[model samples]
Target: MSALRVNNLAISLDGFATGDGQSLEAPFGHAGERLHEWYVSTRFFHAQDGLPGGTLGVDNAFAEQHEQGFGAEIMGAGKFGPPNWQDDPDWKGWWGPNPPFHTPVFVVTHRPRPSIEMDGGTTYHFVDAAPSEVLEQARQAADGADVRLGGGPTVVREFLTAGLVDYMHVAQVPILLGRGVRLWDGLESLEDAFDIEVVSSPSGVTHLTFVAKPR
Candidate 1:
């Protein structure tokens, strides 16, 4: 069976995945780009834009894994766009016409919109469903490939709570966001279920990989 995987998810030392007051201008909210600085400097990120000259190290190595071994992706509505993006019928997503994911992408939202196909192989399918339901949709579209669980913290928490994730990679950034959406809340003792391996990058980011223990 294909695994449900999460990769390159950045969070602060305070455990906030995203800050408060999310807007079209501030996608990561008050947290700004602090969470993703490590990834932005990676060669994998630069390569995505057809650019060159980015850090070639441990951070890049982990960042590069985000696009591999996945045929479908499931993301929360917040990750798809800013607040109330559902209000705008014309809103496609934070990414322009050619979004990054070159696979079927499922957007989990209370307000489902018609599916949107873009320049790349990426196609956004809006669905209003539970975590399991959305996972099923993504798995079906995945065609035996693994499904990537792209998150906005809340959705990640939902799937985590449901015990659906098979693998996850979190980049722990060193910062303190006093108030924001946290990733570890209500997930006490989650480490017991997975075999976690931790690595500290020279870039001051900690890479944590979790693989579910066989039941």
Candidate 2:
């Protein structure tokens, strides 16, 4: 079976994945671009923007993996847009006409909408379903390739709780936002289910990998 993986998920030392006050103006909320500073500094990010001149180092290595071996993606509605995005019929997503996914992307939301096909081969399909059911949908869409578990903290937490994730790569940034949406809430003692590996980078962001152990 194809694996369900999460790549380049950034979180703060305080365990917050995203900050408060999420809106169109503040996509990452009050957290802003702080959580993703490690990623945006990479050569991988520069290449994605069709630019040049970015650091090609340890951070770049992990950042590049985000686009590899994934045929489909499942993201939460929060990741798809700001709060109450369903209310805005005109809202497409944070990404413009050409999204980076380049695959069938499923948006798990309470309100399902008509699918939107973008310029790059990325198509957004909104579905009102549970994590397991959505994973199955993404798996089928992925065919023989792996499925990418794209996320907001809430969605990732649900999948982690459901044991639906096979592998996860989290970039632990050093900053701390005392108030925000945390990633580790209600997920106590989760290390037992997955073998964890921690690698620190010169950029002060520690890379943590979690791979599910065999049953």
Cα-based TM-score, every candidate: 0.97, 0.98
Give candidate 1 regions above 4 Å deviation: none
For model 2, the local distance difference test gives 0.93
| Superposition error at 162 for model 2 (Å) | 0.4
Write model 2 residue lDDT over 20-133, tens digit each, in one string: 899989988999999998899899999878889787888999999998999999999999998998999999999999998999999999999999999989999999998999
10 residues in a row with least lDDT, candidate 1: 40-49
Cα lDDT of model 1 by residue, 2-107, tens digit: 8999999999998999999999999999999999999999899898779999999999999989988999999998899989999999999988898889999999
List candidate 2 stretches off by more than 4 Å: none
C-alpha positional error of residue 154 in candidate 1 after TM-score superposition, expressed in Å: 0.5
